[model samples]
Target: MPLILDALCLARDDAPVRRLIDALGTEPVETTERRIGEPAVLSQHLLFGSGGEIVLHDDAVVAVILHLAPTPSAPRGLDAAEWLPGVDNDATFADFKATFDVPWRFADGDRYFVLEAAYLRPEFVKHGGRRAGDLQRVAFTVDDPRETCRPADEDCPVCRELIVRTGDGSFDLDGTVDALVAGVEAGVLKESSGAVSLADLRLLHASALMERVESQVTCTACGRVACLTLYRDAPPTFGYHPLDAAMRRPLEAIPPVEEWGDAARIAEVRDAMRYVDHEPGLWFLVEQHGDLYLDSRYTISSMADDSCLIRLDEAERQEYHEAGRDSLTELARRIDRSGPHREASPFHRRNLLRHPDEGRDYSAEVRAAIAGHTWLARQKQAAAQRAQAGSAADG
Candidate 1:
């Protein structure tokens, strides 16, 4: 006799857990207090006649364990009068609450403000620690206030030279001989004349006198401090930094989870997942003739959405057998493509035979790679469609 067993762990009030229980329909037989070890990790669990158990950890429902077999030892006698007769419902852990609220996810210490790319709730505190409120509409602009601490002497040659040269409003000086001299005299270049070069000035503005402002906010409840940082008067080294939008865009506020419910939470999760780029299984995308092919050393396959599995060609298959020695005994030694057995050129599709065996079951590697590639392409297309829809709505 053979048996199939499956178990799923979930939060007490999770929707899926409720759905599974409702689907099973059968009433649990006995609810008992179970303990483990000497000091004992203790919990209450429900044992059903169907060989299923619902384990509750610390008043919060955690795991639903199920065991099924054609013939198996019976669980302890189902003698209890009621199944989960009394369950405590008031155990909402802080970590669980934080999962639904994005602001709470990043909050550290006593402050509760969100400053991420999507949402910007400037309010520094959760509403008396109950729930997050709407974003305060605070509008401000960034401009260099043009304040710099200078030596009391009005005619500092370095400052005068920099201002004169940059009078034409160009901050595009590479840290060459002239730039180095200005940096050294202005005390921005800490290392001696010989040590620092063009690389050292990579982070600094070329003209070197960029104005910046920094402000700190204290948490209303615990008096903890957080900084509100802004930059100004910086020249573009090559092109614009994508991070500049952090200041430019008005940050929206994430509402409390209780307000979002399941539907809205799923929407948020789906939106967030668009930004993730999962790595496909390790396999080379090779070009054979004019068509793209995927090979995982053990097997070769096509790049089409519905192509069937194909094993390595006869010549390459012979290489795999010969390189592994006549009996395949020296397999590991030959699999290391770094040594004398290495292929002459990596670009050629035939050179894919030099790749090490990835411990996959036959053509399973190619199958998984194709599946992942297909899924990634679908995700990108869907994200683009959503972006287009959003732009049209805004227009």
Candidate 2:
């Protein structure tokens, strides 16, 4: 008998793979390249000791196929249902065929158990295909407080009174309690007659902030907080951080300091600083006490006496910062300097034609460089438009 687990839809990450391997309790015995479909798409098939096989395409586990012995003899080898639940353990050959709609002709012993992907795949895809097992936080806002409150409880009197006075059971945690308290004081609701006081409810609501209503799990691969689940309607929703727009844009496309203002420029500089050690596109050159400190993705080096590149260690980096040098200002200046001629050589004589001390304000210089880059970009855009217009006229 054979068991087919279809449409796993597992992410192309190591987390799920590692979990699968652990659950199986054995490493893959052999791996072989297999081709399928009319177009002959390549896939990797991993064979396990338990007669279970996993098919992978683009590192995503798409299917798992396992072979089981005939029933009545207690079916030898691994049990697929133990790892993947909801599979029938005591199904007959006829039952398997009828359940899975197996089209092929088979002998009495050739039974098949098919575990459909619908049981697992939909939830995985719903949560942004993240390897995190399940949602940590699930919250919802209701239109009626009575919908969530117990009707038989001691607070029922107050709850009913609230529904009548407020015109509906809907609540605003901040303002509703005060209104309820006021109503009780005005003798509209009985607060002392075994009803839960509005003050106690207010205290309980405030204490909820300290309770663990949600959990956060950091992804081991990206070291980022995993996706969150929110319920705004009947079906739940999951969200991920928006794509990195700044990284996607070319450096020239970044708005100039004058357009973005001082606060925005400062924010950009700070954000870029975080990636200085990891982003190849970002670099910084700082001058401190006649020594030039060059920081890039690969290495942090210092140059003194206009020669001799010395790599800085952790201690040297700390000392450099403690020496009271204007690194931020210098970084802004360098960004300004590189904006116009990013593709050209940094040491090109034309690039260095303006002396380093020509601009006293580094922020102003950065603004000027950004302005120049913007002007050049506009000029190229205008030139492209003119060429396009000429082509249209010719056509």
Candidate 3:
């Protein structure tokens, strides 16, 4: 089985291709040239380092560079697709990432190209007399991991207490009920005689009440923000938290920073922030690690960092989420304002808009996210009152 790495060809010229080839430290051992399709599909297969090859496929117009290692014995190969097949129990992503110390990073002059690594293994099924296998991705975009990282086994006192109280493997319904009743008392919820459901109090839990049965909290010691989600199967444990709508716009504007350890790092880089909302930020889990990292973007003070609460927006949040990706940067790279962009076919346009298409309307999303904030709510109220006054004057 071989490994494959496929990156969307970003550059207008062949500079990125040449840089990648140079970085991999291999030259073409065998070159196979072919063309297909109505407009002639021009492609070149350049074999390198025993079984490794770089395939440059063009629509005779735009091209994509594919890196492949077609044999299992080939060094530093991933079983990505049908071309490269590996056993299901072969080397895992962590195993490869731990040892493969090649310079995967490529830079042409000032421009740096970051390649997201994907590791795959082949899954096999036995036919009547023959065995067949297909490549299945086991891991995608695995980071260059830091080996020393380990999870702390002990939970904080609050979490430990919650686990103890709910050790019978049942959700704390009584506590949830009490929290709802309190919301009514605090004028945050409508008065109801009948029993209140958890479903009805989702917004209340996301907004007014912080310390509730199913609530979110950030650990002071480790700076991990976790949501106390309702679980029936096991003792109450915090799962991956979600970002509330109100906090999403603020999060989107904050610039990406390297992993910060303490509050001081946030303070240092705080002033350069574009969006600085007082409400709690989103909880972010560290990639491939058990520890939770709060998205305390542009938090000026350590006090604000600790005080800020995160409301998990369950509607939009999904698993396998990629954080800190600048979609506009990707959009700009794909769309060519110069050169033969106007002459490019509709097929090429679709390819360019694939990832960043829906993401382009992100400003609208940001505006919608902040639409429910207190300031916006007040503004809407004022506008409504002014409209009423104008109608009265006309009458």
Query: Model 1 over residues 1-395: C-alpha lDDT tens digits?
Result: 00101223344456654554544344556666643211223455655565445555444444443332111322432211122112111112232234324332222212222223222112212333333322211111011111111111112233222211244544424322355445545554322111112332323222233343222222222222222222345332211111111123232222332343355544543433121122233233323233333332321224321112223455544664466323222222232232322244232323323332454342444343344345435545654564455445334
Q: Write the per-residue lDDT of candidate 3 for residues 187-265, one digit (tens) a residue.
A: 4443211111234334333332323324433333332233334322333333312122111112211113233223554
TM-score of 1: 0.16
lDDT scores in order: 0.31, 0.34, 0.31
Pull out the clashing pairs in model 2.
none
TM-score against native, each model: 0.16, 0.22, 0.20
Off by over 4 Å in 3: 1-7, 10-13, 59-89, 92-395
Q: Show the lowest summed lDDT stretch of 10 residues, model 2.
A: 137-146
Residue 89, candidate 3: how far off, in angstroms? 8.9
For model 2 the TM-score comes to 0.22
Q: How are the candidates ranked when ordered by TM-score, highest leading?
A: 2, 3, 1
